[model samples]
Target: MDLDAYVVAHAHEWARLEELVRAGRRTGPESDELVDRYQQVATHLSVIRTAAPDGEVVAYLSSLLNRARMAMLGARVLSWRAAGRFFTHQFPAALYRLRYWWLGCMAANIVVSAVLMWWFVDHPEVEQTLLSKQEVDDLVNNDFESYYSEHAASAFATRVWINNAWVAALCMALGITGVGVVWLLFQNVLNVAVVGSIMTRHDRADLFWGLILPHGLLELTAVFVAGGVGLKLFWSWIEPGGISRGNSLAIAGRTMVTVALGLVAVLFVSGIIEAFVTPSPLPTWARIAIGILAEIAFFAYVFVLGRQAVRAGHTGDISADLLEDRVATQD
Candidate 1:
């Protein structure tokens, strides 16, 4: 319990551990010695925290152990094999597990958009109330169709990707509150319905579907996925089942972060479709077919590879070994 005496007694081992960590590369014997000293120092740090409660000594040991850990494990941080597992296993598994949430979100949003679009078309007065005649005329005659082709394809694609990724990230980031995700998705639904009804009313239905379907399918699906995952995150702590709420929230938060990383690539693909394929000179059917294929491929990724990964015990979390930094104290 005497912090000064304890420091003097164990300072030699801490010094040895530091020496091993600083020794460029390790021989087998030195590596063994480093491992032993690392464990001893960790024990000392814990005892100091619980028994002596010395801030300065604890801070020093914590930093030393952190460096020791990186020295031991840093070489394996970047590996193609790890990346491969992440995409094929971790990402897909998370998708599979969260499929119900996202799938339901996708379905509900589609229905809401369709129904709202129909309502808007049925009640043309609502459009007039919202937009003046000049605005409506401009949107229908030009803006609706020209929007996709207005910008250079690559720049447009990047912009769309960044925008969509931001929305998805917002969903995951604010998922704990539950309201932000719903508000975001609702805003998206409102925008789509308003625009689609305008096109339909102005007798530009073909042009609208032709331009939108090619990219909208996949892009909207990605949005729905994010919304669903966000809602699921909110539910994790609320209905934690048998687990402690903190543990449930922690697990869901980790999973949300993992899924967010995967969604960047998803949003990028959708953005590419939106920018290039949507405005391309290809037949509308052909462009829409590409979008359908992409959407199908995403679903397949979730249901097929994702399911297999889940069966094999992947939960989209970072590997167990890396979570060693988490320490539990007495409850």
Candidate 2:
């Protein structure tokens, strides 16, 4: 069929589409197919305008193009509004699930902790090399037991809590970018490696409880969760299924605010303990128990309590039981 003639014939629909597009309510899936049809027709009209000389085809194509542009703009605006609402409503629930998400983080910490503990137990002299002189001196001579007893009396607790909270929030926020997450993980890995090397040299396997586990458990777990989120996004970029990479990022962005909130809470608590209790005279046995218990608590909440709460609160069919599953399928 002649392109000019076709566009001229569809002038009525084109005019209506223009009005619908301007209305903006005719967006989303309902209008998407219409938009696609309009585009295909417009493309044909453009070709006809270009090829056919001295014909009404140029005017016809112009009219179709204008209408299609309006419709597309309206659809985009409506889609964005809908996305905004979905995120606003879902963010709190996602944040609430961080306790469960921390299960992965806690497990990572345990693995790293065990490796460091084993290495430190086998080698004790590396402690001086791994840690700064100040750290070595404090660990070896500053009398942690005395420090602990006095820590509660000082403003240290409040100071530490605030500091740790910032760190946790920063880590989670950075997780939005793949490069940021890589930098974060590298810094943490190096720091832990150095500390692990030193602790092994000191023949102090229990140092983890005093210097590490108290707040470290929570602090480190938050790091892992942040890393996991970043890593997930990175992998999505690498293998974006059938969708465009930008689309995958949009989905990830949708879920990040909640993840960030959870990280902030975890860090706040870690900071409080690190500033006051960890350095003070708390019994090594007690610290170990607390650390171990906290790890256990996280897993229990994630696998048990989290599921129950989500099920009770969410009556709509969720399609899947796990977060990863839902995300994957949706993407």
Candidate 3:
């Protein structure tokens, strides 16, 4: 049978059997019947698991966990709203969790960019060899700020976001292919080099302020989050430690939801600023200040605020709702 049909046909019986097995129920006729049903369902699920690779299974499982986590988070946040809480308590912990992936992505990107910058600095003529006349003119004339302000708003930005997001998702999905992480790192590094070249050519040494410092603080953060999610699955196969790859992937997959959700938030905010704010007529000082403040807020959310959510002790009512929801879902 198809998966949904198989699940529907035996889900109740399987659940009953699980409950009975957990409660130390013995093999009476009903128990035997439930056992038979459980075996059939288990066999089917096992076949499906075997046919799928670890990444697909982990992705499927992660999706389920993500839904549950989001529901729980939403309900809690809603309750906090009712009680007049500002709901900033969860951001810092989330940021802390994102740190691993961001650092990894950033390190790889930075090294490549630095090397390229050194090469270009050593060979200025190479710029003309590579760049087109228009590009060379812009770089030589230091006109990127105006160019960025204009192009960042064009439909090209949307296309860029979609294309980048698609690449990230595919890289994340392709972790099953064993080379997904490497592929992702290569693309990330290349992008960094290209951007760095432009910044260096224009002598905008404070490139962070104009090119990246504005919305980049968020956009790059999202990219790092995406890379981290991919690394989770990649590491499962490459260096799972003592655990089996499947189990390691499962564990990492659980955390991927949090990272992906946070990435979504980052992308949404970044896209808006990139489209309207980053490209517009803002003073360099103001842009730098905003960028710095935004980064600080981001760190505070992921590291400090997120950790406090579990212990904020708002009320037991929210906890009761959580338990009830879990029980209902399980039932």
Which candidate's TM-score is highest? 1
> Which of the predicted structures, 2 or 3, would earn the higher lDDT when compared with the native?
3
Ranking 2 against 3 by TM-score, winner:
3
In the range 195-219, model 2's lDDT, one tens digit per residue, is 5555445555466346777777766
Worst 10 residues of 1 by lDDT: 322-331
lDDT of 3 by residue, 1-331 (tens): 2556645665575566545444433445744554454444444445545543256543543344344334445444556463343334333343454466657776776677679767776777776677887876665465655655556375646755675566656656665564676677677766556556656656666753465677777676667667666766677667889989876776556455445544555666666666776766778778767767777777666556655653564211222222212211110
TM-score of the candidate numbered 2?
0.53
Top model number, lDDT: 1
Worst 10 residues of 2 by lDDT: 322-331
Return whichever of 1 and 2 wins on lDDT. 1
59 Cα displacement, candidate 1 (Å):
4.9
Per-residue lDDT for 202-277 in model 1, tens only? 8999998998888888888888888888999999999998999998988888888889989999999999999989
Candidate 3 residue spans exceeding 4 A from truth: 1-98, 138-143, 151-164, 202-209, 309-331
- Which pairs in model 2 have colliding backbones? 100-302, 120-200, 123-200, 124-201, 125-201, 127-198, 148-280, 148-281, 161-271, 161-272
Model 3 residue 138 CA deviation in Å: 4.6
Between candidates 1 and 3, the TM-score winner: 1
Model 1 spans > 4 angstroms off = 1-77, 325-331
CA RMSD of each candidate after superposition:
3.9, 10.5, 11.0
Clashes of 1: 0
